[model samples]
Target: MTAKRIENGLMGLAAFLLLALMAVTGIDVIGRYLFNAPLSGAFELTELLLGALVFVALPLVSRAGAHVEVDLLVSVVPRAVSRVMGRMAAIVSAVVLAFFAWRLAVLGITQVTDGARSVSMGVPLAPFAFLGALTCLVAALFGLMREMRP
Candidate 1:
């Protein structure tokens, strides 16, 4: 899919996940206080939702060009130099972020293989890891492309 479409989809998914988190959390709290029992997997669900928030936000932030950048130096630099500097920054960012993606993937796979799961919820943690790693990889690719821009 195109970057724009991917970004839009991610943003929408993030919003939906956040909304779901809030609703679930509220229900869980009410159930605990009003009744005697809380949702069985509420905590685990929240943990997974936290990962979802970060994973989904990355691409949207990239597409919006909302990530922090120091434009002051670039503004004063010559146009050609500024362009080169921007590309260099982008390349560095992509490289570093790609490493993060690698790490997350490794961690996720290890957990999955080990059969790691949430204590209360019994949900496998692999999905969160895999989703987060995939999104980071996508963002790294986008950054690499941005860096390659003329």
Candidate 2:
């Protein structure tokens, strides 16, 4: 399958997770205020879902060239110079993201070895960490693709 398709799938998952998070939070808030009882582990689940949403969407956003940027230099620079600078920026972004992914992989392994879990729900964290690392790596690849593009 193509990278664009994979990125789109990840973006869809992120969107679904975000909607789920909203629902969970709404239920928790309403239940707590109106019913005197809140959903168990709602906060922990929200935290995990938020992380998943960001990481999963990263690659799609990178691929679409939708990331926030300061384009002040682009307005003043010649077209060729601007294009060169943009490519350079993409390369730098890819390198930074790759390093971040590496660190996340190390952290995930450590979490697994240490038996880390969410405090409220005891949800295993290593899986999510590893997922984040994978997404970050994908995002880095997308950045490199953008850099290589004409």
Best by TM-score: 2
Q: Backbone clashes in each candidate structure, one number apiece?
A: 0, 0
- RMSD to true structure for each model, in Å: 2.0, 1.2
Error of 2 at 9 (Å): 1.2
> Which one wins on lDDT?
2
Model 1 alpha-carbon drift over 4 Å, by segment: none
- TM-scores for candidates 1 onward, in order: 0.86, 0.94
Candidate 1 lDDT, tens digit per residue, 1-150?
Answer: 887788778878998999989988999999999997898889888878987898878866765667987688876889989888878887787788788889989999999899998888788888788888888888877776766755
Residue-level lDDT tens digits of model 2 in 1-150: 888688778977988998999999999999999999999999899999998988998998899889999999898999999989988998899889989899999999999999999998999999998988999999989988887877
Give lDDT per model, in order: 0.83, 0.91
lDDT of 1: 0.83
